[model samples]
Target: MLEILTGAGLTTSAGLNAFIPMFALGLLDRFTNLVNLPEAWAWFSSDVSLWVVGVLLVLEVVADKIPGVDAMNDAVQTVVRPAAGGITFASGIGTETTTVRDPDALFAGGAWVPIAIGAAIALVVHLAKAGTRVGANTVTVGTAAPVLSTAEDVSAAALTLTALFLPVLVAVLVVAVVVGLWLLARRFRARRTRGRAAAAPGGSEWTA
Candidate 1:
């Protein structure tokens, strides 16, 4: 089920892809009845809109080009992504009703597990991207470069709302690209690091 949701076709679909994570988050929230504040902000913060989110996402793609900003962005995103995920999940859950059961009871009875799962997934994805950005910065600009990392900040806000109100397709596509980029960047960084190390002094002596 997870594989099917995150696959290329689903991820590429603008409406479904963007909202998948949110839907998952929502389902979890529904089962748990937990109120996550950060997620709330992602959805309600007027400062961070869909347009802003989209712009930030675009900026993140070239974050390595800036340096310090990239690292900062990673740090900020670390906290923001999971919260946003949780909020999206919770919000999504809040939208639906359990027809046969008392809504309050249902919320209290089985929401946390899904919410926790959503949060965990969001955290894992967030950390992976953070790690990737760090690597990209290290490779392209060394450790001291300063790049604006707030690129995704906007996207998070926008995506959160889109997941909440617009078609889920957009959310899924964005998430897919975000995940895909992270994977590609990691592989590229690994290859480059290996090539660089192999070319260094006494390089041949080190066995793989």
Candidate 2:
């Protein structure tokens, strides 16, 4: 139960920022006693891996803050985020985190199941976020790009930490992410529809 929550939280955070969960998990597993990664996954906490993840995270952060570059970044992240989410989710489930007692029995039938489920979860959240971002960019003329990116970074970091140490709170954060993204997407869609309707001839929305 707690293992699933941790994985879900990590995967969800990956949807927002691909490297945060990885970086956090790696650091904790390497430096602290909070996370004991399985032998197969121990490489995540290596110094070299941390450096690579950090560099990618920096690049992702900078690119996602720009206007047009953000869109392009999202396009690229459409793939990277899902992959990262899968890895984080699987690692979260397989690792012995502070909250994850007896992580081995959490999931059966090999690692593919958790990986696939995590990928799907991340993909859905990513879609919602991407949709909301597009709408936000359109409505604000890209002025809100930096703000949105910063908010996502904060949320990702919070979720990663909570999922690792205080998994009981992960459900609340995941729900908030889902609801926030859904609301933003709907609001943007409504605004875009209104804009389209107003622009059509005779205020008609029948344009093909």
Candidate 3:
């Protein structure tokens, strides 16, 4: 189970790492009586519900592709994801119930571990992708870069759903997509930079 969680964390970080913590929190909420809201969210009602997980997974993918919309989504999700991850981790620590015997104690006991793990994974994923975006924007003034980012968003969503539904297949696919995207984005950036440099005045060493 630890191995599975670790692998899932890595794969999720590749795309929707920003939301992994939130998803984890949602999972936590299902196990313990930490948050009343998880109970309200039908999809997060049960840990074993494939349908709900699948829907959330799909949303993660869609959220990644909405052009400038992802920036807004990221801002909103930064807080939401960690909260969700905390909730999921808390839920995973115990069983669901209308009331928790000792909410503070239970949270302190075993809930923090998974929440920390999930949040760490999410932070790494967001940083990597955010770095990539910053590099891309520096090279290309935020033009069609959103298209590539959108692709990554979709990939993240697919990987999440696939990991839940078909772990083995998704693992292979995620690795392939990540490698492919990295190469493609690098090449695209290089070409754009070269083109920009060429269009400028003095060869590739101009000041402005």
Candidate 4:
């Protein structure tokens, strides 16, 4: 139960920023005895993976702050984020069991369940993120995107780190963030529609 919650939290975090969970895991594994990777997953602890993920993390942060670039980046990550979520979920489960250590279990039947759940969660979050970002760009004219990106990065980092110790809280926070963003996006779209309607031919327009 705890493992599942932790995995879900990690998956949620990955959906927001795919590299954050991986980087957090790698950092914990390298600096402390907090996390132990399976034998097959030992590469996550290697300096090379650390450096690569770290660099990508930096790139993602910068890209997410730019208006047009962030949208393109999100589109490109449509495939990548789900995969990262699946991996993070699997790793979370793997941390709790010795089954992951067996090469044969990598492709075993039951292993796919968590992966699928993670992917689904990630896809949902990704879609929501894309919608919200598009709405934000339209409403704010890209002026607030950098601020939004910064908040998202901080949230991702907080969720990733919190998943290590307080997964239930992370889950609550993720739900809150997603729901709040969805509501705000919906409101923006509604306003946009009304504005367009008012500007249409034969529609009322105030001169004052």
TM-scores of the candidates are 0.49, 0.92, 0.53, 0.88
Give the candidate order by descending TM-score.
2, 4, 3, 1
16-78 in candidate 4: lDDT tens per residue?
889999898888777877677656567887999999999999999999999999999999989
2 against 3, candidate with superior TM-score? 2
**Which candidate achieves the best lDDT against the true structure?**
2
Q: Could you give candidate 3's per-residue lDDT for residues 130-202 as a string of tens digits?
A: 5566556556556555576666655665664454334456457646765765776676667667777777877
Cα lDDT computed for each candidate against the true fold: 0.45, 0.89, 0.51, 0.79
Clashes of 2: 0
Q: Tens-digit lDDT track for model 1 on 1-208?
A: 2221222122122121233344333333434433232344334323345445545545644553466765675576566555555544443444422221111222446656545544555666666656666666656654423332333433444454444334334446466656765775767588667767878887752523
Candidate 3: stretches off by over 4 Å: 2-43, 46-69, 72-109, 137-141, 192-196, 199-201, 204-208
Q: For candidate 3, which ten residues in a row score worst on lDDT?
A: 95-104
Model 2 bad stretches (over 4 Å): 202-208
- What TM-score does candidate 2 get on C-alpha atoms? 0.92
RMSD of each: 9.5, 2.8, 8.4, 4.0
